[model samples]
Target chain A: MNEILADIERWRSAGQRIAVARIVDIEGSGPRDPGAAMAVNNLGEVAGSVSGGCVEGAVVLEALELLEGQRDAGITSFGFSDDEAFSVGLTCGGTIHLFIEELNW
Target chain B: MSSIYESYRDALQAEEPVVLATVIEGKNVGSKLLVFGNENIEGSLGSSELDRVVSRDALGMLEAGTSEVRHYGVDGEARQDDLSVFIETHSRSPQMIIFGAVDFTRALAAQSKLLGFRVTVCDAREVFVTRRRFPMADELVVDWPDRLLERIGGDLGQRDAVCVLTHDAKFDVPALLSSLATSVGYLGAMGSRLTHEKRVDRLRSEGVTEEQLSRIMSPLGLDIGGRTPEETAVSIVAEIIAIRTGRAAPRLSETTGHIH
Candidate 1:
């Protein structure tokens, strides 16, 4: 989140709606631990990353859906443990639980 | 309108220690409590009692520079799992105070930065401890080791480190001695095995307790066959990590065959 603050602020200044995907939990050998986060704007721009490139693409889709109003902000799971829910899985075979939410705190 | 994100971003950008405790599972999932060091809190976790307990725990986790998900009851009871709060800490980075401006210092400083440590290079000799010599160091102090520590020792805590790389007794003794006076997490000295043996005797003469002497990882760094300064820097950081994580620094080659 710290690394992406500049980008987030820039997008906000441009009046872009933003969604945040934060890793709330991880099981087994995860590349990034809990608290890892990524942000996606309505334009599909991304900042930060929640995984080692494996899950960011999927996270971007989730963020876009949340922004599109087609999906509600809530918990989203990815990685091998929840492969049924997500087509993508962490290459390291760990499960990561993320909370997708609008930056409307 | 002001929001918890505004305060959290402000505190983080100021490099102040802060914790963002968020409810990720259960009622009011996504509710947040922004916790500061002095028990100053903003936002809520849907219940004041839950906010109180979570803020207290968040401050503790912030001090330790760790983030994790913890379970609690609706009102923050210990034995229930009705809610999961992701207590994410944005503590100030750990500090690495290097007490030499040698070739190894530059490498070690860069390595420490890679591990998210705020690096400080200190040496009494102004000629070597230059900003040009160690451009990556967050601080370059040209002062006596003891005096420098005197100004900053109280701020050192469990996540801080002190590395005395001055092999000379004149500088090494005061460096390691002053380091012992602090609660820095890792204390190490760089030298050969024989050199550290002589240092141990000198330290004993200075009345350093056996327990304090034992805390020093002399002949610093893991036995990773590191020959170059860069490789040695890796070994030293690896040793610091192993010590911090309470793990044995065993070479993977040596850990086979079920010797344990």
Candidate 2:
């Protein structure tokens, strides 16, 4: 969050709807720890990251869906054990749980 | 009226200790409660009872400088997972107080800053401790090492560090003695092996116990075979991280288990 505050303010002031995804937990061999976060604007611009560049694109997709009202805010998991494993699993073979939500608060 | 994000951003920008507890898996997902170190709270985790319980837990996590998820029953019961709150801590940066503003201090100060430590370079010689010399230092103190420690030692915790780069006995003796009095997690004195042996005898005579002496990582930093000041700075900060993480530094290829 600290790393992306300037960008968050820039997007907020520019009247961009934003969605935030924060890592709530990591099971094993995770590159980043909990509290790692990323924010995505409705325009698909992104700031910060929750993983080692492996799952972030998928997270951006989740954020965009939340922003578009196609999906409600909830927890999303990415790992080798996930069904979409081949497409967006963590290369380190760790599981990461992220809470995706619009930045309404 | 300030929003929760505004309040949180202000606290973070000011480098104050703060925590954000968000209900991520339960009724009222995304409800946030901002918990400050003083036990003051802004916003709520959907109920006064939940707020009371989570604010307490968040305060503990803030002190440890960790963030993670915690489960609790609705209305804050003891053993239930009805709600999962992600308590994200925003603690102030750990401090690195470097004694002696020498060439090594410049490298270490720069490296410490890179690792997010609030670096302070201190020495008795005002001529040596100059802003021009250490542009990356958050503070430059032109005073005796012991005096500075006496002033700031109370605030030193398990996360803070004290590095004594002064090899001279006259300055280092007092510096080591006073550093032993603080609870700083890392206390390392820079000197050759023979110099450290002599310093150990001096420290023992000064009544520093064997256990207390063990806390000091003299001839500090891992044996990374680093010769240059920049390389030595990397070794020292790497040692600090290893100590904090409770990991013995070894090659990743050498160890097979969890890398994290």
Candidate 3:
């Protein structure tokens, strides 16, 4: 979050409604730890990352849906689990739980 | 309407220590609170008693720089799970104090910044310790290592690191002694076998105990056979990572290990 603060500020100043996705938990061999964050603006502009390139595309999709009011702000999980809720999975075989929410607060 | 967010943003922008506590579960879902130092909390957990207890616990967690989900009774009583509060602390960056300001110091400072450390490049020689020389460093302190450490030693913690790149005994001896006095987790001194041997003898003469000497990584960095400053910095950072994880620095393919 600290790393992306400048970019977030730039985007916010430009009047971009942004969604922030923070890694709340991880299971198995995660490339990044909990608290890793990625910010996505309504324009699809992105800053920072929650994973090692994996699941970021899905996160962008989620952020866009959130901005569109198609989904509520909450946790999104991605991994190689058999549940198959998310098509994109981490190559490292780790499960990451991300809390996706608008930057309203 | 913007006061809470503004305060949070300002604190984050200034790199001040703060924590955002959110009611993630139970009755007051989405309720928010802000905790900073020992000040009165800005928001509530739907109850005065819950706010008081959670604020106290949040301060302790902020000091340790930890984020976790804590369970408590509706009114903050223990041994109850009526509510779950996620206390996410926004701590100031862990410090990396490099006591050398040499060529290696430049690379190390750059690498430390990449790792999200607030790097301070310190050396007694004002000529070498200029900010222009190590622009990547967060601070350039032209002072003796011992003097600087004496002032800030109390703040040093397990997450912090102290690198003594001054191979010269004149600067390194005092630097090592001062670093040893602090609780800094990684105390690395850059040197070779002979230089480390001589340094050990000098440290002993200065009343540094064997236990304290063992804590210092005399021949700093892993045995990666790195010759250049940048490569050496990578090796040193890798060593720090390995030390923090308590893993034997070895090639993964060569050994059967848990692969943490």
Candidate 4:
């Protein structure tokens, strides 16, 4: 979050609508811990990351959908599991829960 | 129309501690509550009672510098997992105070900053303690170690560190003694085996007890066989991380352990 603050500020000043995806919980063997954040503007530009590159592309898609109102802000889980599986699973075999929301308070 | 992003950015830029609580599960998905010291809060969860309870828990997580999802009752009742709140804390970065502005100190300060520590390089010698020499350090203090610790020791916590890179007995003895008074988690002094023995004797003569002596990591850093200043800096910072995480760091191939 600290590293991407300048970029966030720049995008905000240019009046870009943004959505944020934050790693809220990790089940096991996660690459990044909770609080790892990624931001995506309405233009689809991204800053920061929540995973080691495995789930980021999927996360950007989620962010754009949230911005477009196609999907409501909520938790999105990505990983391989018996119950459900994501196409972009974590190679480390951990389930990460991300809270996706717009930048609006 | 104030955005949470603006509040978060302002808090971070000013170095003010803050925490963001998001309702990830239950009735109010994506709802947020911003919390600071005490019960000062902005925004809210769906329920007033839930907001109160979650704000209290957020402050605790902020102090520990932890981020996690916690379960709670819908209206803040206990023992009922009706809601999940993800509390993300923005705590100040841990600090590293290096008590010698020597060659090793420069490398260590740079490495410390890279590892997210706010490094402060202090030395009594005015000539050696210059901001130009340690551009990576958050601060370059030209003062005796004891005096510098006196001003900032109260803020030191288990995550902070104090490294005495000055092998000189005159400077190291007071530095180590003053550092011991604080709760800084890692206290490392750089020296060779012979220098450590001589320094130990000097510390004993100065009336430092055996218990206090054990707290210091003389011949500082792990046994990584690092000879250069840059390599030694890596060893020291690695040791700090291992110590903080309670990990007995060894070569991965040498031990069978659960990697978390």
All-Cα superposition RMSD per candidate: 3.0, 1.5, 2.8, 2.5
- Model 3 TM-score, all chains together: 0.88
Report the C-alpha lDDT of model 3 over A1-105, residue by residue, as the tens digit.
778888888987899999988887778878877677899999999999988787899999999999999998777899873435545888777788887888877
Q: After superposition, how far is residue B100 of candidate 1 from its true place, in Å?
A: 1.8
Residue-wise lDDT of candidate 3 within B133-178, one digit each (tens)? 8989888898999999999988998888999999999999999998
Give candidate 4 regions above 4 Å deviation: A81-86, B205-207
Which prediction has the highest lDDT against the true structure? 2
lDDT of 3 at A55: 86
Ranking by DockQ: 2, 4, 1, 3
Tens digit of per-residue lDDT, candidate 1, span A1-105: 898899998998899999999888887768787788899999999999988888888889889988989988788998673546656887667788998999988
B-chain TM-score for every candidate: 0.93, 0.98, 0.93, 0.93
Cα displacement (Å) at residue B171, model 1: 1.5
Residue by residue across B80-130, what tens digits does model 4's lDDT show? Answer: 899988888988889999998899998898899888899899999999988
Chain A TM-score for each of the predictions: 0.91, 0.94, 0.93, 0.92
- Ranking of all predicted structures according to lDDT, beginning with the best and ending with the worst: 2, 1, 4, 3
Pairs that collide in candidate 1 are none
Model 4 share of native interface contacts? 0.86
Candidate 2 segments whose C-alpha is farther than 4 A from its true place: A81-85
- Assess each model's interface with DockQ, reporting 2 decimals per model: 0.46, 0.88, 0.38, 0.71
lDDT of 1 by residue, B1-260 (tens): 57899999898899988899988889987899999977899999999999999988998898888899999999999989999889999989899999989999999999999999999999999999888989999999999999999999988988889998989999999989989999999999999999999999999999999999999998999998998989999999999998987779777587743211
Full-model lDDT, candidate 3: 0.86
